[model samples]
Target: MATVTESAPSQAGTEKYIPFETSVNYEKVAVGGAFENGRLESSWYKYASYLPHNVPGKQPPLEEFQHQDVGLRADPEKKALLNAPGAVFDEITPAIGTEVHNLQLSSLTSQQRDELALLAAERGVVVFKGQDFADIGKDRQREFGAHFGPLHVHQMGGQVKGYPELLPVYRDFTAGAVDNEIKNNVSSIKWHSDMSYEM
Candidate 1:
């Protein structure tokens, strides 16, 4: 279950107590549109307005999706990918992310691609910056993506005219007809503190 700690007032009520951790000192926000953004001071159980009426999730047959995980299967490939002459790695956390430097994704050997997959699966999120991916053009970009696996067509979000895999996240114009017009509102929102990466 999610947990929270105690909080003290700011300098205005400084005489009461001083804070050791700034993250615990959260101010309550009471406004019109800030409901979801604001962090309310409450226990995980009491904060949400509802309790589960049914069990959380169910298992499904995995024959279609089953495959040897790259992290486990490509152990030897990770060495060649990381130990290249100029390649460098900075693990973001002890657990989650990694930043790989001095390695160009565009010029990877076939084995290095498998190593990349391994690194990604093991690290959870691998970040690479200063890439030539943008200048390579749409065809090259699509080809590179296809090298990983079958391209995922986004069910929602704007796509390029010919390329269905590229989901344009940054949009200034009005949303299309399939946007959150049907059931996406405050009423339909699940406010409970479940493990949600989607939110």
Candidate 2:
């Protein structure tokens, strides 16, 4: 449960974020139309593009998902409220990237995981702060990402030892400033998206 404090503007702007005294799930996630129960659910309804397709038993392709209304498969009532984070909007675009609170990726039901993927898709990106990758472990990280779709094995960058799907990007300033340069620094500072490289 979140101890709601007075709403305040985020560092970037006057957009309000309900501050929490402790680490708590965001109380309300952005949702669209009401479900059969006459209550709004998560932003999953708007994130159809992000949901996985071509699973052996779970979910079908994007076209099939829309046609068959597979979004209703999971019972929202059964979902643990505390496990899901609340949506924090960005000042410019709400769908660009939403911040969520108190979601532990290591442990989530299939439905919960699906909701998360949908949330990410809807929001473009979902931010979870203070995540300890060491504690979550490589396997858990892979599993959590797998919930969205098959993990991507990068052609470039350092793989996480035994896990090819896990790419570690790091910089060692101690080596030297020039060592960190990317291809003569022409496009080193460019904003890149993983989607650009997707097959």
Candidate 3:
């Protein structure tokens, strides 16, 4: 269970406290609340909300999924990608969300991409500002995700016109068909793992 200390008053009135080392973003905690089993559980909704009850559809067999190679690495000479001076990160919280600045997602080399992944792993979620990923196109985006393993095609949501592997996350100005997805039980505001429904 979480180590709760003395209660304190905030806008939420007196609330239990946990160590910052074990805390997560307040927004997520506010939305999903948290459980204790030693540490605060702030990211459980990501996977738990995507179960068959939440998202309808049979997933592709595990055998069809691409497995991650334990020995993946970029070219040894590509050291510049590891320490690109153009990129900047501002942590939104001590536990989650880092806004990345000036890093060109399209221009990163394989080794650089590995470094980017490491940064994301270190900082829960990494946000890139003002990136024109549309111009970068579906193929490149798929290739970038493929660096880790096979890219997951979303079971729900809009895919690019020709790219089934690419999901369009940007809000288009036009109103399109509303997806019949489970929403009352699932929150877009909550944090979840990508395709957590899949094993």
Candidate 4:
């Protein structure tokens, strides 16, 4: 009689991400509904087109990802949360006592905002960089953050004029014409996780 062997079943919750040589994975990225066809068929093409020409030297043409069907699928609960309205918003409030710093907010879109809010809730304290606070203003920032819960005020001075919840993150400075003072210098910046020092 011939010997028979059976293949092991695929593991649950395994996700197949498109393999790329670069450190970043660019496959199966959940772009908006606009590009669901698995091709570069959206306004995003304009931004992607610049990468190759802008960088000097030979570059690879954009190719369809192989092994696209290899990953384990998302469970119903995970899919529901990802697609549900306000699910991401619900996550922001839970991050109150956690230590999170230096988040890249500009890279995230409206959809990602929901996911980020969820991350903030679970992780506690999310800091964002490259955010243009000019349009948001002090009041709006405070108000938006307050949706999660009551805002906490800083112990030392640095609160915004009307909104005490908005901290100014102050630094001591000295008057000197030749040397750069603390106010002018961006170096020696110590960014601690919010509320870590509070008693």
Best by TM-score: 3
Error in Å for residue 126 of model 1: 0.6
Task: Give me the runs in candidate 3 sitting further than 4 Å from their true place.
Answer: 1-60, 64-66, 69-82, 170-198
TM-score each candidate.
0.50, 0.49, 0.52, 0.32
> Residue-wise lDDT of candidate 2 within 1-199, one digit each (tens)?
1122454455666554544333112123324333334322324343222222222232222231213222245444424423456533232233365565555556567776656555554456666665564466667788877656556666545466567677655332233333355646765354567635333
lDDT for 66 (candidate 3): 50
| Candidate 3 displacement at residue 88 in angstroms | 2.1
Q: What are the per-residue Cα lDDT tens digits for candidate 1 across 1-199?
A: 0113345454663332212221222123222322223443223322122211222343232234434544455555467788777978876545667777888888777677778887787678877777776566667778877767666654444455566666543311122222354356655323443223232
lDDT of each: 0.53, 0.47, 0.53, 0.39
Candidate 2 wrongly placed segments (more than 4 Å)? 1-95, 176-189, 193-198
The TM-score between candidate 2 and the true structure equals: 0.49
lDDT ranking of the models: 3, 1, 2, 4
For candidate 3, lDDT tens digit of each residue in 1-199? 0112453345674433332322233235334556454333435544332112223465465455556552245434334553578666566555666676888888877677776666665556767767776466557778877887776667776555556666655321121212223245464344557766666
By TM-score, the better pick of 2 and 3 is 3
User: What ranking emerges by TM-score with the best candidate at the front?
Assistant: 3, 1, 2, 4
lDDT assessment of candidate 1 = 0.53
User: Residue 35 error for model 2, in Å?
Assistant: 57
